[model samples]
Target: MAGVYDFTAQSLAGEDVPLTRFEGQVLLIVNTASACGFTPQYKGLEQLHRDFAARGFAVLGFPCNQFGGQEPGDARQIAEFCETKYDVTFPMFAKVDVNGSQMHPLFNYLKNEKSGLLGSSIKWNFTKFLVDRSGRVVGRYAPTATPDGMRKDIEALL
Candidate 1:
């Protein structure tokens, strides 16, 4: 079966990053938006990244504009907003569709590995998927689920 490491994504900087680069690390993959209410979660996600990076964990952010058109910025704009507003230091990817026919392949794999409350289709932005060190999807979190609330799960995997 395919795992997270089988895919590649474009970073905000336009580099094509192979997910294999993060193979041995626990990862928190989140669909993000700059103008959404859950935007503040970036801070908590960054905290998670800082607190656990030395322990081989990372928070990977993917900007998605599919939900209410909340993240309509270009790559440079998104990068600037995340850095200036939230001081986000975690790795972030370019904008991609999380639902419908145009959905990114990485997201397709993630949703198939762990379906959400509404089934395989994501309901909104900030949806998070937790992957273990072995590249298996271990947990799926809703947009409303706070990053702080997920600490125990993350710690257990770490």
Candidate 2:
């Protein structure tokens, strides 16, 4: 596959969304887990989305259960938790495997483009991949890297 735009992912609402729809926007693609310690990063991620959306920046969240089954919730439950707890307004996708044989194609492409400390395999929940406006994976951030801390990089892209 080429870049992120080459993939299609299911939305949290069960709609098929072509990544090409976001082709011209700078993206922060994250593997999220509802019950992980990094779950609170949703607030920061939402803040990022709100702060830069007008400038063509977006945060795309993908719920993943590959890590210790931290995100065990179904689509409805995950959507509810995100809306009620973090008031997240960014686009969120359905649950997917971030590693192993069942890994989503988008993530596979991302990891191949920008490997982290774990070398292409996602380390844990909240691992982030920054994509430029052209859909090229530009940066890979570890799970511990806070969304807020990535402002400068995101800003540069915008």
User: What are the clash counts of all predictions, listed in order?
Assistant: 0, 0
Q: Over 4 Å off in model 2, which ranges? A: none
Pick by TM-score: which candidate is best?
1
Model 2: per-residue lDDT, tens digit, 1-158? 48799899999999999999998999999999999999999999999999999999999999999889999999999999999999999999999998888989888889889988857788899999999998888999998899999999999999
Best by lDDT, which number? 1
State model 1's lDDT: 0.96
Q: 109, model 1: CA deviation in Å? A: 0.6
TM-scores, all candidates, are: 0.99, 0.98
Model 2 weakest lDDT span, ten residues long: 114-123
